[model samples]
Target: MKLSSGTIRLIIPAASLALLLAAVFYMQPRAMSYTGLNLLFNLAIPIALATIAQMLIMSINDLDLSMGTFVSFCACVAATVLQTSPLLGALIFIGAIAVYAGMGMLIHVRDLPSIVVTLGMSFVWGGLAVLLLPSPGGTAPTWARAIMTAKPPLVPMAIIASILIAAVTHYIVMRSSFGVLMRGTGGNDRSVERAGWSVIGIRAATYALAGLFAIFAGIALVGLTTSADANIALRYTLLSIAGVILGGGEFVGGKVSPIGAVIGALTLTLAGSFLSFMRISPDWQIGAQGAILIVVLALRLALNRLEKREKHQ
Candidate 1:
């Protein structure tokens, strides 16, 4: 039977998630319990949000090398200014979003590689975060903590939040008319320009949206930890990119999926937990993640080949 591109995309994430779930359950049956699930998924909200942020940039055929530092900066702001001066924190966050928009504009105007621009911005963000919080000691605001600690009925808050993130982002980026335009700009800027749209504006809006999501991720991280550090979320950069790819996003051509990204994040989160349950060393955990990513990518490649052969036949 021939599988369509959409089916092929869905298969990878679905299969990967199922396999992870099976492995986790097999390794520890107790993980099926509510408390265990809560523990496992506690950190998923922030990762899912970060993955969405990465997905937004990937959807535009661009990448934000600074996303991790940018998120850490927001966490620093949340821990310091947001806790002490709410008004100031709001303004700072707004300024950060504007900077993201400006980066998009600069990239478009200069026709510069997104990687080069964002890589430089990463250092700036990291420096600002260090300046804001030299140590990991600031507290999360009461409101932020309350939101993160809220216990909903039947399901864990992390799961609920992940679902909502996936649903909301999917609607905004995959269903809305404006979404089509944004994706069109990524898929083919010249074509979109000919269609009477400002490609630059679309790109800027996408970056701003990504920044907004990253802010949510940072705040969530602070809420969970009740503190912040300049280097707190540095690992998120590579993890988020991996999540997007595992979830069926491409590096170019505007191919991306919000739901898949969330699923991908969840799978990776579970993979880490599964490894920890088996007493894997922290050093090996990172390597395990890389290995899992490689295996999934290889599976995706095989699926693509199968699809092509089926079509030819």
Candidate 2:
């Protein structure tokens, strides 16, 4: 079967996921069952959400170093305040989203680097998270627990949730008119501004969306863990960045594939499981993850070159 370069690109992420999942299942045959699959992938929902959140930020050629700490803060709120005072907790979430939107404007107006801004905000978020959970213990709300534990007839909730996120995000980001403006803002801000669009407003709204999804990721993490800690999602920063790159997203140019990002999350989850099955130590696993990310990045660059060569053909 002859496949065009475009078709090959589309299948690469899925192919990688299938291979990773197969390797993990081969390592532990018992995990081939439905219950085992659920156990293996349930936590991926939060990671997938986080990856999408990071993708949104990257779509504007910006990196969000605060994503992990901000998610940790939200998870702390969901576990403690959300359970006790729902309205107040909801307001806090909204305020956090507003803060993210405001940051976008602040960075735009000041002509500052997003990495530096978000990196500083990371410390701010980490401080608030520590304050929220000094001792590292709080119960997830009842509804959150129920929703996280829900099991449909055939498919696992993780798969269902990831698919939903991918589909909805793909539409909003890749198809809609609003999406074009957002990408254009990143690709050529001067052109976008000349077209009569408010670049600041568009940036703020996109950052707000990123904040909202990161909140979802935090809530989902708390739901799965049934508790909260100050550093619950610290590793998510690197994982989110790795997933975006593995999923065919570029650092700039506003290029992204929502489905590819979700598949990347799934692949990362399976890779973790494979490592666990092989009894790798936590420290070593961290090193291994870094190596894997480097390899993926190299592979992506090679693929990009191939695609470019084909275009020139």
Candidate 3:
């Protein structure tokens, strides 16, 4: 029996996640318990959210090099102002979203490369984060801590949250009319404009949505850590990119899968934990992640080629 392209795409991430779980359980049977699962997936929420943010950018055929720094900046605000002055923190977050929207507008108006613009903004965000926190010390608000630490019966909160995030994002981005327009804008801005839609507005709205998700990622990170550091989420940029690609996203085609992206993030998270359980060095974890990504992508490429050959035959 031959699998369709959609089935193949879904299967890859699902199989990767299953394999990671199996490996972890084989190494440590105790890891199959609720407590063990919670510990293993505790940090996955932020990574999943970050991956969604990246997915939003990718949906519009753009990249956000500043995503990690922006997340760190939001974490700093959550740690400081959100803890001390809720109103001020809310305003700052809103302002940050506006800035992201403005970036989209600027990119569109100036016909600038998204990569170059976002890369420059990464330094700006990093500098602001440093000025805000200076050092790695700021407390997460009570609400943030509460949300991150909440536990429910029968299942881990991390899994529940990931499911909810994926569901909501999938509905909004893949099942809604506005989502269609945004994706169309990416797939063909000229066609979207010909249809009397404002491509620029769609792009800006997408960027704003990405900013909102990044804020969620930052807050979640702070909640889990109970503190903030400018560099805390710096590695998320690459991780998010890898998750999107592993989840069957194309960099230039406005194609992405919300459920797959979350699954991919969870898979990477578990793979990292698996390495830790094996007593591997921290430095090797990144390399291991890259290796896993490469393998999955290679398999996906092979599958695509096979599908094409079958179609031709």
Which parts of model 1 are misplaced by more than 4 Å? 1-4
For 153-257, candidate 2 gives per-residue lDDT tens digits of 788888789899999998988889888888888788888999899999999989999999999999999999999999999989988988887888778988777
lDDT of 1: 0.91
lDDT of 3 at 95: 96
Compared with the true structure, what per-residue lDDT tens digits does model 1 show for residues 259-297? 999988898898899889878999899898888889988
Local distance difference test scores for all models: 0.91, 0.88, 0.91
Q: Who is ahead in lDDT, 2 or 3? A: 3
lDDT of 3 by residue, 245-312 (tens): 88888898778888889998998899889888888889898888788888888888887887788899
Question: What does each candidate score in C-alpha RMSD?
Answer: 1.4, 1.8, 1.4
Return the TM-score for candidate 1, rounded to 2 decimals.
0.97
In the predicted model 1, the residue pairs found to clash are none
Q: On a 0 to 100 scale, what is the lDDT of residue 229 in model 1?
A: 98
Name the regions of candidate 3 deviating beyond 4 angstroms. Answer: 1-4
Give Cα distance to truth, residue 295, candidate 2, Å. Answer: 3.0
